[model samples]
Target: MTQVPFGDMKAHYQQFKSDIDTAVSRVLASGHYILGPELDKFEKDFAKFVGVNYAVGCSCGTEAIYLALAAMGVGPGDEVITVAHTAVPTINAISMTGATPVFADIDPVTYVMDVNSAESKITEKTKAFVPVHLYGQMVNMEPLMKLSLKHRIPVMEDIAQATGSLFKGAMAGTIGEYGAFSFYPSKNLGAFGDGGMVVTNSKENYELLLKLRNMGQSQRYHHDIVGINSRLDEIQAAILGAQLPYVNQWNTRRREIAKRYNEGLKGLVTTPQEASYGAHVYHLYVIQTENRDEMQKYLSDKGIQCLIHYPIPGHLQKAYTFLGYKKGDLPVTEHAANHILSLPMYPELTNEQVDHVIAAIRDYCKEKNTASVATPMSAQVAGR
Candidate 1:
């Protein structure tokens, strides 16, 4: 019986135990826990990696987006356009700014915001577009940027899932007005605890973010504007800094694992696809199947852990009922919610473990006679 976990953070930590421990010790000795040198260095390093002029660190990804929206002046009576199939935080961040969250359906194949659908939903009230880079694959930013310039709407990228993903040679988060990232332990660039970053090229926006994260203070105890206390702590920043150097190598391994999964599970499941315009970092090797529930149960029984990235689209959730979205409003998003399953995915996932997981899924598919039904979308599947 093979036991493969969905994500092994412990394994990840163990791989870098020495460096991480040293970083943590250094931070502990500094005695400046809140917004110290660690945070500053990590922000600079992350900004350099993403090719942004400034990167602002915050408590978590949700706040990162909220800060971006708030700083960009998204407020009451405004509407923020985003895909329905994303972490609730994406919508919550918009709503927290007292703006209406406008939902758009995702592209069935990419499971990202459908640009056309998003464009149609834009109105006079639409203030910003938040294209979630879900599952480590970038949304098509080329058209999204054009739409942003045309409609005069600022684009805030929810890059919680994509850290190193590229779009036409540019990094995923750098193309938008603001890019928000999460370092939740399961992410590709997981920190020891909750962390997030917002990046931007505009000096004006960057300065606004710095003020917003620290209660609108340009100087200590000098409140410039009403803001929230959401600074990224020094400990988490140090941990992130330690992990930062290895992100590219980890992303490469994740892609290799995804390729193997695609080849092994070709006809058994609808695997993730990399867009022609960008690279996928394989944050979670999600697959879609008609028998998602049974498949998950089968894998669980075989000691292969599997989970759903999202079982329900955000619009259909009880929290967003006021948004006026119903079940059939977004067919593609609804369909994906019912069928997507995230398999064991991480940089540390071994070939043997990946093979075992694939073998278990194939066994279940054979027993259930679930031949692949991914047509039109099959060409989009990575390594197909």
Candidate 2:
């Protein structure tokens, strides 16, 4: 039996073979691959798409986060608030900047940083906050923005999962002081390889971020400040530029697939929520379920590919346990780690594949229930 894939990058690449090949060959022929015209054009075009004044292209999403923080002047003795349920990269980016990452629990329903919790966790050392647009759903930026306004703290948005999402007519990346986007191959607006960019409305900050990504060189080998090397490659920029025009269209297809999944799995699992003010881009189509492990195994046995977005929350990881988070400290974040199962999702996934995955899940649930019923009722109750 052939197995399906969670992310079908080859299928997506096949759709733009000619343009991608041409873009790469052009860069190879130019012999000027690093930070060339391709990158400049991509930055400008992406900034316009996000409704921002400036964009600074960087090497990767993690690098982009660090650069954005540096540009905003966050460093040692500073603290930035973020959710612990997300990827470790978000928190590590802050730690790598010589700043402490103060984490709050996510909202169980929305899987986004709970603004109320975030506020309660702020302290004197708090210099900035990152409200991640987790799993393609925009965080409630209005409240966070209001909080930032009240406290005069800067906000850098982690919009890696929400490339084209919006909250109340404002784009996801445009609401904060700086918005960092990832073009990892699995993202909705993915590049061929690793890439990320930071967008900002502040001209000075944008210039600084640009400089920070290129070893602080205001000019050739002219070191302005201590900075790290992180530049987006030219070939990736060209590929991303070619695909930029069609990002919205692909996201629309993803939305349609999300709708089908919602309808198909209504009673079987807890589907992702769409807040009244925000649009969801369906990055992974993550479904919450109590039987995630068993479901994952069943899907594998059926040759259906599934994945867990994160089996371990960032705060509980061995790398971050030194931050003083003990088990059972964050109930919501822990619950999320046990339940999130990412279904097969991509813009190019066929309708038949979607239906097959849905049916497999339904059948698996039925079989599990039947097996449990076959056991003694008293034993089953005791097990529960």
Candidate 3:
């Protein structure tokens, strides 16, 4: 039996071993590990890639969001609106700011934040809107920006899963006031270890973020304001910088794999819908089926590894019970959480592996008696 892992970071390293090893060797020789030239180069290069005027390297995605919010002075007595369907780190970052994370439902088709639901969650205390680009798709930013302007609220984009995604030809992190990206080992442009970045066009925000990520040091331990120790280390910065050039190629491969999954699994499952407003980089190729748990088990038994992007919505989690959200508060989010399952996704996955996984899913659907109503790929496109 052939086994397919959800993501093979070791394989990824092996593929880029030469470059990664060289980067590590150079950084080790430099002996300047913290706040060094490598970090500066990567920040500038990443800012150029994202078409932003400034980019701040941080320890991780959660800190990226926290730094952005802190730069904007969002804290206690403030409210930040975001979706309940995203990674908990999104909410955790908001919580780190001492602000309340108000929940909003997601769009049924795109599975991203619904602008209308976000608008409804606003109040006088609403400080910012953090629209998470979940599963490599950018949210509809045009209307969201209009809403931001109308309500006088800032937009912070969570680009953890959307490193190279685009919206109306604009880069993912460039459209909002702040864009927070994660370079976790499994992302489209992942680092060898934990890393993150925050991009912005505002020089003021950029300067403040520099201070916030380094314990509020104005210059050499002269504390200016309250902050945290969240600087991106030299080694991780060098590794990410080396990987940055290949990000677009990797994203293209991910899209090609997604297209294959859509074609092969169309009728058997509800395939991901890419909104016309943006390109989906396919961070995780998710499918929706009524028997998600059973299918996951079947796939596991077949030596095909699978996982759920999220099995529980953030608002309904036990840790967030104090938020006062109940089971039915976010109907779409709650419903999708039960049905969505992520198939193995990575640029390095071969066609044979993808076909094997697809065959397993097709087999599962056929046995479950759900193939009779499988929809055509055309019919399953967005806005249907």
lDDT of each: 0.90, 0.86, 0.91
Question: Model 1: runs farther than 4 Å from truth?
Answer: 372-384
lDDT string for model 2 (205-266, tens) is 98788779988899998999888889889999999998999989988999999999889887
Ranking by lDDT: 3, 1, 2
Model 3: ten consecutive residues of lowest lDDT: 372-381
Locate the minimum summed-lDDT window of 10 residues in model 1: 375-384
Q: Encode model 3's per-residue lDDT on 1-384: one tens digit a residue.
A: 888999998899999999999999999999999999999999999999999999999999999999998888899999999999999999999999999999988888788998988988999999999999999999999989999999999999999999989999999999889999998889989888899999999999998999999999899879898789998999999999999999999999999999998899877788898999999999999888776788889999999989887998999889899999999888788878988889999999999899999999888777876762323223333432
User: Cα RMSD (Å) per model?
Assistant: 2.5, 4.8, 2.4
Inter-residue clash pairs, candidate 1? none
Best by lDDT: 3
Clashing pairs in 3: none
Ranked by lDDT, the better of candidates 2 and 3 is: 3
lDDT value, residue 93 of candidate 3: 97
Task: Report the error of model 2 at residue 218, Å.
Answer: 1.0
Please write out the lDDT profile of model 1 over residues 1-384, one tens digit for every residue: 879988888888888999999999999998899988999999999999999999999999999999999999999999999988999999899999999999987888888998988998999999999999999999999888999999899999999999999998899888998999999999989888899999999999999999999999999999999899999999999999998989999999999999999999987778787899999998888898876797889889999988887998899999999988888898778878888999999988999999999888888877877784444343543322
